[model samples]
Target: MTDRTLTVITHVDDPSIGVLEAAAADNSWSMTMVAPFRGDPLPGVADLDALVVLGGPQSAYEVQDHPYLSDEIAYLREAHAHEVPVLALCLGSQLLADALGGRSRPGDNGLECGFIDVTATDPESLLNGTFFSFHSDSADPPPDAEVLARSDRYLQAWRTGRSTAVQFHPELDGPGIEALLALEGAKLRQFGVDVDAIRESIPTSGPQPGRRLLDTWLDDVPVRDPAHH
Candidate 1:
């Protein structure tokens, strides 16, 4: 008998999760990517091992503009119902929360771009650490979900069942962060952000800790049923 390589499906809203791709490879997981924003179809969760939803510039409430946001929410809801482990970041987190009876809306405190330190509810949580952030919206996770971490300004991480969600971008390295900033340059400038200052604050130890956090998810999150692969 041969062991089948686990397959992880990633929904890419932006192509900045290289760190996550690397970590998935390290764990010998093969990837299947779907980009609903680009009109790609989402796959059924029953055959997959895990689902990873990456951050995006779109708001969770903008279904009229980006109709695919509705599709993603429905898809994630299905995945959760089947007990598939989901790893959602930033915009992805908001969508997951909404699918599971939570609400996502414009951040009352405004955009949180750049590196920020988050407090972990558990002192030794892998979700703890300074992570790169970029979001103008926030999510209040489902009423039954366990809150894992938070910053002084916003909710950072939460988990329910086999799924996990984090508002920060642990998948981005320095260049990746720069690329995201460039995408949102005009908005940042409009908000009086010093683009150069945020550039200087990019942490050298970014990708390493991010990978470790991912490793924890893969190793620790309980799987209900073995995937077909």
Candidate 2:
């Protein structure tokens, strides 16, 4: 069996981490967690088999507020240039879109802060149905990017060349969803969100279907031959 390592960049202690860990373990791939704000960059990211950029509360356009956002985007660009497999989630996805010459803009309608259904724009296979969304920003796919999915609130997902970015949080499960609801309760309230309504919108069983989609996505990612590196 070929050994592969996937690097994950994260800022907050999200519940999705657990789901990702479980998914990687099941696939026999090891994962290394790194915080760009704390950890130093790897010597050669190309050596890594796959890359996963996780979400944060920061916006991709707020480079001045969070300088590391630029660094992370640069790193993603380098990885993409090297043709390394990449999957970007939430803010990470916006960063990917921005790094590839696209723009992430604040939504005119407002924040999308619940379980929303996304329709597949293309038969790309990695994304097909509804996904959990929790962002206030929207991204326009780069010129070379192919749109894979979308929803009423924003551009739900897109794929550019070898990389894919999703605005939704597929890694979130029951507990994670609950935690988010608790943490962002004030924000939700300010937006006139009803807690019971939000809770009711989320299925009691968590996002198993989304997990299945992720499993299929991992299998579809083009594995690189170690010999090439």
Candidate 3:
């Protein structure tokens, strides 16, 4: 087994997969993608160094509509119980919050689409600057979770123990964002999101800075020894 293998759980096909693949390549880490649609789970989740849960179109409350969500939540809860380092984005964040006793509900401000600025609550944490957000629902974090950032749209980011969840897409780069716009242009237009405006908002750069932030957060996390648990 590789010393630094990360398990990624995602629903459907996301344009940001290339970004994540590149990040893993840079880190010299092995990754195994587990798509819920394919009915696959981590073989030995406890042996993983990190867990990454990606965004999905469905809300956390729609477990009845999507049976895989129940299984996914269970797996996430198990990972949390073991103190695994988990980074959840968008709908995955909402699921992580719900799995940790938080409540996921319809966002009061409706859908938070396009690019938005997130104010950092804990500058010492992983998320310290602006991020890309696209979601229709928000979450009320559990007591165990710490609010790390906020935006006008919804709870931008939160953390509980070793697990960190963000309502934004820090893993997305310029090209990835463009691919998403192309794929969901019609939907975005329906929401009154101007394609040019969204394109202008995306920073024309890489994700090294954001990856460094994530690495910092990982450094602060206490690595788990199998014997301890």
Candidate 4:
């Protein structure tokens, strides 16, 4: 309990855990960041008190182009088997699905970007509310997963054992969303997404429902003895 560690696997630079940094600080949890995109080695799951996999622009199915994704999928599978608490966002969620006997594919409903309202499909689910979303892919979670939430277009969140996966980002705030737009805004416009309008519509109230969801996950992460695992 004295050195709680949260390992973050980031696929890209832009979408680091936004609001979660503050949560880690407030909870006195130390964090280690791993960037597979930059060829940083992934620390073993046993070293972690919890795990977080951030979003990225890469499609989960493009393993041929990004072979490191295979490594990550294996890593995630190991973590899941160990009952490690995982909070997977966007691309990370897709990867988790792929690792857990599920599937990730191009969304039939097209791109689900901007702030979208997600409804809790399970009545007892703790996840519901507006979360930032910017992705063209979707995960059909593993058969055993408890489907928790969804947007009108696709599955938004699900839980299986100790892992919780969300297709929408719960870690992004206004500035984070703005930075993401700055990186891919033009590409979004090609798909009829009004980047400028999304920018204008950015909430000034700061991160909310997302932060609440994150807090719920944090509270549920189990602390483990290093020697025991």
* Candidate 1 positional error at 157, Å: 0.8
How high is the lDDT of residue 84 in model 3? 86
Put down candidate 2 lDDT per residue, 1-229, tens digits, no spaces.
Answer: 5656778888765435656777777887888887876655653765768888888888889999889888988888888888887889998898998889898878777888777778887666646676667888878879988887888767877887779898888877666777888888987899887866777777666545467766766676677866766
Question: Where's the lowest-lDDT run of ten residues in candidate 3?
Answer: 208-217
Task: Return the top candidate by TM-score.
Answer: 4
lDDT of 4 by residue, 86-153 (tens): 98999999999999999989999999999888899766665767678888899889999998888899
Clashing pairs in 2: none
Q: Give the per-residue lDDT of model 3 (tens digit) for 8-27.
A: 88887643755566666666
Report lDDT (Cα) of residue 79, candidate 3. 88
Candidate order by decreasing TM-score: 4, 2, 3, 1
TM-score of 1: 0.89
Better by lDDT, candidate 2 or 1:
1
RMSD of 1: 2.7
> Could you tally the backbone clashes for each prediction?
0, 0, 0, 0
User: After best superposition, candidate 4 residue 147: deviation in angstroms?
Assistant: 0.4
The true-versus-predicted C-alpha distance at residue 229 of model 1, in Å, is: 12
lDDT: the better of candidates 1 and 3:
1
What is the C-alpha lDDT profile of model 1 across 1-229, one tens digit per residue? 1222333334455587778777777776667677787787777677666778888768898999989999989988988888888889888899999999899999988878777888899998877788888888998899999999999899999989877889998888777888878888888989987788888887666345477888767665454355432
Q: Number of the top candidate by lDDT?
A: 4
TM-score of each: 0.89, 0.91, 0.90, 0.94
Residue 27 CA displacement from its true place in model 2, Å = 1.3
